[model samples]
Target: FRKVVHIEQGGLVKPERDDTEFQHPCFLRGQEQLLENIKRKVTSVSTLKSEDIKIRQDSVTKLLTDVQLMKGKQECMDSKLLAMKHSFSS
Candidate 1:
């Protein structure tokens, strides 16, 4: 915004003398393309982040399930070892 120091001098936002560059069709289309590209890139990045989150959740669930299964097996093995030790002592 241009600061008009003297309001009496009539610098009240006149149109530019040459607007040929702004009026060019290529400039307008290029600006739209730039906006579209930025939106598309943001959407793709967001999608990737969502997919990564899902993958992380799935991996963590699988890991916990695996650990639970191993815990059960270990308990069973410990019981079997105790039984074997008692049999050997008797």
Candidate 2:
């Protein structure tokens, strides 16, 4: 003859037995808080990266505009120099 033991309160039986390695409530809460902190840090770093890129783009645009202005000035000076040289030679 064989005897059967029932550990669960209801008629439903769990597929796996409860292990002793379950995490404490406080430990689970601390893990959740750590995860949230990591998410916040990631978001702030992403925002900073976006701002840095925008600043770099603005700097590049300003530099390009300055270069164009310099080119125009150089062209005007070159024409004046050529006219002066021709007049001196004649």
Residue-wise C-alpha lDDT for candidate 2, range 1-90, written one tens digit per residue: 112335552326553665323333334553666443332113555567777989999999999999999999999999999999999999
Q: List pairs with backbone clashes in candidate 1.
A: none
- Give the distance in Å from residue 11's predicted Cα in candidate 2 to where it truly belongs: 63
Give the TM-score of each candidate. 0.47, 0.47
- Cα lDDT of candidate 1 equals 0.64
lDDT of 1 by residue, 1-90 (tens): 123234443456654552322132233443776443332113555567777888999999999999999999999999999999999999
Query: lDDT of all the models against the reference?
Result: 0.64, 0.66
Worst lDDT 10-window in candidate 1: 18-27
Model 2 ranges with Cα > 4 A deviation: 1-48
